[model samples]
Target: MTRRDIEFDAEGVTLRGWFYPAEGATGPAPTIVATHGFSAVKEMYLDVYAEAFAAAGLNAVVYDHRNFGASDGEPRQEIDPVAQVRDYRHAITFASTLAETDPQRIGVWGSSYSGAHVLVVAAIDRRVKAVVSQVPLVSGLANLYALVRADFVGGLRESFDVDREARYAGDSPAMIPVVSEDPLGPAALPTADSWTWFTDTAKLRAPAWRNETTLRSVEMFTEYEPVAHIAAISPTPLLLMPAQHDHLTPTRLAIDAYERAREPKKIVILPGGHFDAYVDGFSVSSTAATDWFVEHLQP
Candidate 1:
């Protein structure tokens, strides 16, 4: 497997990352386009997944979402679900243009936030032949409610309004930690596991990973609903992988969304929490996705 640094224009923003050509392939081969979740960048184990796909004779394009990691965008660390979805389509277009890519044999693989994005992308973009959405956010509003305390919900909304006003007045967007040591602290992801996984992964694999994002990013997240597009992803084969003990995206919510998806779809229940899918359960998660892509894309 060989990896090369690559970038392409997504609208006007320049998104950058690695492209791994399928190993031992003599011609154009099936390709998988992937990006990370939430505030994650390509360095945080995305390379590992890409290598796995490449070694299995499937080309892999792995990049960071705009405004994070090596990607170019304004407001540095903002998270806009709508923009991310559009970027995924742009990535597909770029992938289709590659010499090593069999445009018709393209599959999409995403986990967590991008997982949800792939669901929406596959529904609207017929160019996507197959999809693997792992531990995706089904309903952002529901997820916010699940992760936040009832008493804090109103305050959180108020903070959003306050931040909007500040931004309207030309003040820089307010920043918030992506995760915190104190579970009850104000952060995008408050789970103990999120803190551990993000901090530890950053330390070991991605020094460029930051701990902050714009406050409005959280507001935008609460308004996202990718599951609304789930049922439409049929005809295009779908593989839904939800971790058994996930609380960040909630296992039940993922299962419910999976039930709504039409046929030519399958689900693999991973044996750990959300973050575990990338670490402890990586072999299971990556293998399931690799096999699915192989079955459908025939790389």
Candidate 2:
């Protein structure tokens, strides 16, 4: 499979990544627009899914959210869920303009934090014919509790308030590790799995990825639940893949969201934790996702 550099404008920021066209194709084909989760860059195994899509006779567009990776945004390394969501929307518009992919048959695929993103993207854009959200977060409150130690909970909240003041006053947003050696320390994700995955697995796959995030990023998590939008993604096909042992996003919350979603939806619960699905367990989920897009987007 071959990929080309690509960029799109979203709310005045330029998001950058790669666009993979279907293998040996000279004409437009079904396309899947994709992005990574919180504290992740495009190189962190997102290409695995995009290449799978390309090999499956579908085009794929993989991009970094604004303010992350090779994208252009101020206050770099800050994770903004709201801005990321808008970037996905603008990615749709960008994909439609590409000569390598079908304009009317675009799909959106995201995992972890971005898994929650696709739901909202699909709900608002009728242009998205299908969606694949893997181990999606149901509620920020639940996810926050699952990600950090209880003793550090108060510290996490306090960091946000402090960061906001600093940010507004032209001070650098409080810097926090995206993954820490201590589970109780302040970080976007501090579990043992994430520590190993981000520190080890990501280094192998996404060497360009940084392990830091802004304090404001974690602070914004509380207000960004997309479970409420899941129901609205109907008429358009939805594919929700939640890992069975994903403590980060939690399988139960995804199941709960799945139960509330409308028709024309399918859920495939696979083995492994949230980060596992990005590497060791990627095959199962990506296979299911590729088939879903081929079946829905291609028809």
Query: Model 2 misses residue 269 by how many Å?
Result: 0.7
Estimate, for each residue in 1-299, the C-alpha lDDT of model 2 and write its tens digit. 66899887887888899999898677889989999998789988888899999998899999998788889998888888888888898999999998887888999999989999999999998999999999898788877877676777897677778778787999877888888887766667877788888889666877778888887788788778889788899989999999989887889889999999999989999888887787788789889999999999875
Count of steric clashes across candidates, in order: 0, 0
| CA lDDT of every candidate | 0.95, 0.87
- TM-scores, all candidates, are 0.99, 0.96
lDDT over C-alpha atoms for residue 146 of model 2: 71
Give the range of the ten consecutive residues with the poorest summed lDDT in model 1: 1-10
Q: Which numbered prediction scores highest in TM-score against the true structure?
A: 1
Candidate 2 ranges beyond 4 A from true positions: 24-26
Candidate 2's error at 10, in angstroms? 2.2
lDDT of 1 by residue, 209-233 (tens): 9999999999999999999999999
